[model samples]
Target: MKITIAEYLLKRLKEVNVEHMFGVPGDYNLGFLDYV
Candidate 1:
């Protein structure tokens, strides 16, 4: 049942019907992008 913050966030975004997002790709953003 362990989930990362990034995983949780992406899941919520999908629930709200978010199909795309824009952001700079960098070291800090890599973790979140892994979910996408």
Candidate 2:
């Protein structure tokens, strides 16, 4: 099975038990933030 970048990150977060993430919105981070 193939996993997308977003899926991979979410899976990793779950493994680490990350419930929330914080960050300010920026041009570069917008795309990544949107995925989260």
Candidate 3:
């Protein structure tokens, strides 16, 4: 089976048990942080 990048990343995060992701508000990281 093939998985998209987003799906793959979310699965990896779940596998690692990453409940919370922290980051400050900034231009570059804002989108990534928001997605988390």
Q: Of the candidates shown, which would achieve the greatest lDDT relative to the real structure? A: 1
Candidate 3, residue 9: how far the Cα is off, in Å: 0.3
Give the Cα error of residue 5 in candidate 3, in Å: 0.2
Please, what is the whole-model Cα lDDT of each candidate in the order they appear? 0.90, 0.84, 0.71
Query: Rank order by TM-score, top first?
Result: 1, 2, 3
RMSD of each: 0.8, 1.8, 3.0
Least accurate stretch of 10 residues (summed lDDT) in model 1? 27-36
Q: On residues 1-36, what C-alpha lDDT tens digit does candidate 3 reach at each position?
A: 996665677789999999986657888765555446
State the lDDT of candidate 2 residue by residue for 1-36, as single tens digits. Answer: 997787789789999999998889998777777678
Better of 1 and 3 by lDDT: 1
TM-score per model over all chains = 0.82, 0.60, 0.50
Span of ten consecutive residues with least summed lDDT in model 2: 27-36
lDDT of 1 by residue, 1-36 (tens): 999999899889999999889999999988788788
Q: What is the lDDT of residue 24 in candidate 1?
A: 92
